[model samples]
Target: MLQARTICATVALAGVVLAAGAVPAAAATAAPARAAVTCPTGWGSGAKSDSDSTATPLSDIRTGRHDCFDRMVVDVPGAASGDLGYSVRYVDRLYQDGSGRHIPVAGGAVLEVRVAAPSYAPETGEPTYPARAGHPLPGVNLTGYRTFRDARFAGSFEGETQVGLGVRARLPFRVLELPGRLVVDVAHTWTAGG
Candidate 1:
């Protein structure tokens, strides 16, 4: 009886040890298997449309950086509702919106950006996004971005504006509508694991 009790205790103790060891081993194996950060989907190589219309003209165009992607923002006053639409896609070459002149870009890929709303005043046909002759025009300084090379105004006409984006490589991109602005984000990679 004494030997039987000792054997049973030893078996039970061994089972407990095995259970404890398994918990850590399972955790370790699952560590690398952790779910990676998922980027927003349904943003593909095509025109993304937001039918909601806005008369508010674009006030500014800018770019910022994030861990996963680079951001471009088109600012328009009083556009809190997503009444604006856009067409953002990769292209073989860029052209001036009104003149149809070929634009030379700095990178391997070109992103033609078209905004549905105008960037000018209707009454006097005044310039909202003023252009500089013989200069590169208003563009963001993409000093440290992994994918972005350059961005500039292609042109604006017929109540639409165009901005051309030059990138190191053709990359995944997304667009959004925020208060007073339309945003474009180009991803650093297909999956931003961080």
Candidate 2:
């Protein structure tokens, strides 16, 4: 009888434990669910954000690669340089910034990056980032980037300088002016990690 009572108690304990477990399982299933976080499309134009012109001139142009996008940074000296605004967009054809002559680039799409700061020194009329004969800026190397095909210095007019980027296709691009630098990020595709 004692053995039988022990077995009955064990069975009752197991039943209570199972009932407790089921309550939590049902509660978990009834809980609300959340959707995955999705990023916005990279292609589009940003509102024109202007700033006071700077004497701190653009000193260098550099490019790098990321998992999702290609980056181009225009190095400047100080706040004056960062405050300089920019206009970046997809264009049908890249023309010389000042003269408007047609410039034939190497890709199916062209991104025109026009900066409010010049790449030259103001006092002596010398270039901070000297223009290369056949290349875009003085020391840009686009050897391995998948989306970037060609880039060129598209001249400076008034208080702005232009840089033409030849890309694989008409993808999205963004221009950001920070203190001492102007940055351009080009998406590799319409979807992330493409």
Report lDDT (CA) for all predictions: 0.77, 0.76
Q: Residue-pair clashes per candidate, as listed?
A: 2, 0
* Candidate topping lDDT: 1
Instruction: Tell me, by TM-score, which candidate is best.
Output: 1
Give per-model TM-scores: 0.73, 0.71
lDDT of 1 by residue, 22-47 (tens): 99999888866545566665455565
Worst 10 residues of 2 by lDDT: 39-48
Query: Model 2 off-target regions past 4 Å?
Result: 1-52, 80-82, 132-134
Model 1: per-residue Cα lDDT at residue 62: 85
